[model samples]
Target: MTTTDAAAAQSTAEEREALRQMAAEFTRREIAPHLQEWEDAGALPRELHVKAGRAGLLGVSFPEAVGGSGGDLLDTVALQEGMFSQGASSGLMSALFTNGIACPHIAAHGSSELVDRWVRPTLAGELIGSLGITEPGGGSDVGNIATTAVRDGEEWVINGSKTFITSGTRADFVTTAVRTGGPGAGGVSLIVVPTDTPGFSVDRKLAKMGWHSSDTAELSYVDVRVPVGNLVGDENAGFWYIAEQFVVERMALAIHGYGIAERSLELTVDYCRQRSTFGEPLIKRQVVRHKLVEMRRQVEAAKAYTHAVAAQYVAAGGPNEAVIAAACMAKETACNTATYVTDQAVQLHGGTGYMHGTEVERHYRDARLLPIGGGATEVLTDLAAKLLGYTR
Candidate 1:
């Protein structure tokens, strides 16, 4: 390689190492201690957001101009990998970095006023934000959203509800998807709705199969009035904006998938080494050694593929059709790896793994959400088929 190329490579390595170390330290100091408490409480302290922001961990992949710490997708991958490998669960990642989903559209499209009001504070950790798209019965069908935002003089009266909203109960503002025009995709628009609005309310906190520390809510808006200025981008253009973000969100999930797998494998390896089965170390058994190797192999492969896709995304400046299909594949691949690896981790840990308080148990539960959340594996498979032109 040329001198310039070598320098660039060196610089990148240093940056990645620094990000990883920061993630490890932050997880160890700020999160791991109180993880169980937060999980039991069903929410993280709002103070955690402030600490993450102070540490520049909250907006690592966001634009610096908007109170973010100027980084890219790969930086986020490094952070996630580091955190997971250091005992942080996927639930913590989602709750802490909900901004990765919530503020992107606004940072990229919303007016400066909107950015100042929501994006800046969110990135700075002073405010919590959530993306409201999935509705009851609608699932991943963004086009079929039942929420309506009709213009009434200077304000838009929004009437509808969003379900499975991440960080919803604690969000100060939500970047909500609503119908503003005709039917289907063309009618959709994104509007920022403050939680203080009179008609907006959290219907209830939905208890989940995993990610216990992350708060999820079913939110309702009954004739909630928001200013027209709160609209993100142009009217009836939210679908494209949301579609554009799916690439990153899916990629992030892919990273989460393998990161968790890698962590589980690490925990399992240590367990196997020290765990005695029939008076011998579990690792002494051929079957146990093979299982550990298989777990590592899968985790490495998933990480490599996900990182490659992330690199391609960075190289291309943005995601295109090809990148989108590959992202779907990456997410599915990593999530499947996570499932298998975490299960093996539990199996290797024997009865200890089945216990609720065990680390491997938490990973096992957290890994279960990978395939189902973001875009479900089935839905993404269909999307990939269409993207690859397998569908007529």
Candidate 2:
């Protein structure tokens, strides 16, 4: 490479390192200590979001005009990696950064009034926001959602329920997907639904096998009155927003999956060297050694693939159909890697790994949701195949 090219690359690397350090410091001080307690309690305190926002970690990729630091995708990835490396749980990240999913649609398509009302508070961490799309009957199938928003004078009367909504229990606002016209993707629309709206209520917080610190909810909308101005983009164009957001969401999930597993592997390696069995260190055994080696290999491979995909995504200027397929592949790879690594970490720790408070154990539990959430592995594989023209 030329001297100028090398200098620019170095500059970027330095900036990434600086951002990583900032995130690491914040994770160690703010998140690591209370993670177990928060998990046991099944939800993190809202103050965590305020702290993160004050630290400039919450708006890494957003525009500076929107209360962000004007960083790129690489900066966001670095922040995620640093948080996991410093012991922040995936659940904590999800709960604290729920705005990433919620505000993007509004920022991309909402009216100026809508943006000021919701986006500003969300970025400032004064208000919580969540994306609501998954319905009771329709899981990841965005096209066949049963929720409807019928026009009634100057307002839209919304009726239906959404399940598996991340941060739903605590969100001040929800960017909801509703069927505005006929069936299929063409009839979908996105709308900003405030929690205080009449007939909008959180039914119940859903219990999950993992991500305990992140509150998930089943929400009910019974004749919810939302202003017509709340519609995002054009009416009957919600599918495009959903598709765009899914790609970024999948990529973020992929990063969280692999990053957490990488941390688990690091902890396990240290334990193996320090903890002796049968008058020898665990690392002394060839089998245990090979296990650690394999864990490293898998995590490294997944990270590399995820990073490459993220680079491609930014290069392509946000997500499209092609990037969505790539994001799916990356998420699947990272999730599978996380599962493998966490299992190995647990085995290496033997009895302690099986305990509830153990980090590896927590990671094992958290990793379970990786494949099921975002988009299921089976669904993603099918989508990818269709995208790649494998279907007739």
Candidate 3:
């Protein structure tokens, strides 16, 4: 390679390392210590967001003009990888980074007033926000949202329920998907509703198999009224907006899949070296050695594929259906890797891996959610089939 090309490569590597280290440090210092307590509490402290915001960890990919740290999507990926490297659970990352999903639309297209009220505070860690998309019976059917938002002179009155909402238990507001017109995709609109509205309530906190620290909620909205100005972008354009953002969301899930798998592999390797059975360390056994190597291979493949697709996504400069299809494939690949790797990590760790306090155990539980959350693996595969023209 030419001298200048080598220099550019070195610079890029250094920049990526910097972002990674920043996230790792926060995980080690702030999250690792109190993680178990938060898990038991079933939620993270609101103060943690402020600390992360002050550390510039909360807004890595948002535009600086919108109170972000002026980084890009690659930066966000680097941050997530770093945290996972430091043993941060998927649940903790989801709870802390809820703003990543909640504030993007507002930052991109909400009126200045709405942005200031929701997006800025959220990125600043002064407020919590969640995206309300999935409902109890209407999972993955964005076009069939049953929640209705009717125009009432200067305001919109919303009535419906949202289920399986991340961070919903504590979010100050929600970016809700509501039906505003007819009975299809074109009639949906994204509206912001404050939690304090008399008719809006967090009905209950839901428990899950993993992500114990990230609080999920079943929310009910009964005639909740808000100004029409709170609508994100144009009326009945929410389906398009949600579709535009799916690539990034799927990429984030893909990152979680591989990131957790990578961490699991790392822990398992160390345990094998130190763990003894019969006459020698587990690493001395041929079968154990082969398992370790295969685990490493799968993790590497998943990581490389996801990162390549992410780079393509950034280079595209906007939403593209082909890229979205590729992202769905990436997510499935990584989730599959994570599932296999985490399960092996547990098996290699033997009885200890099954214990509740073990990190491998935590990952085993957390990794299960990736294939189900964001968009379920089954749903994404169907979507990809359609996107790729396998069906008419």
lDDT of 1: 0.93
Candidate 1 — which pairs collide?
Answer: none
- Candidate 2 lands at a TM-score of 0.98
Tell me the number of clashing residue pairs for each predicted model: 0, 0, 0
Tens-place lDDT per residue, model 3, 205-227, is 99999999999999999999998
- When summed lDDT is taken over every stretch of 10 residues in candidate 2, the lowest stretch is 65-74
Model 3 ranges off by over 4 Å: 1-10
Over 4 Å off in model 1, which ranges?
Answer: none
For candidate 2, write residues 187-265 as lDDT tens digits.
Answer: 9999999999989999999999889999999999999998999998899999988888888788889998899899999
TM-score for candidate 1, residues paired by index: 0.99
Alpha-carbon RMSD, each predicted model: 0.9, 1.2, 1.4
Candidate 1 structure quality by residue, lDDT tens digits, 229-332: 99999999999999999999999999889988888898888888898978999999999989999999999999999999999999888889989999999999
Q: Alpha-carbon error at 318 in model 3, in Å?
A: 2.6
Better of 1 and 2 by lDDT: 1
Candidate 2: which pairs clash? none
> In order, what lDDT does every prediction score?
0.93, 0.90, 0.92
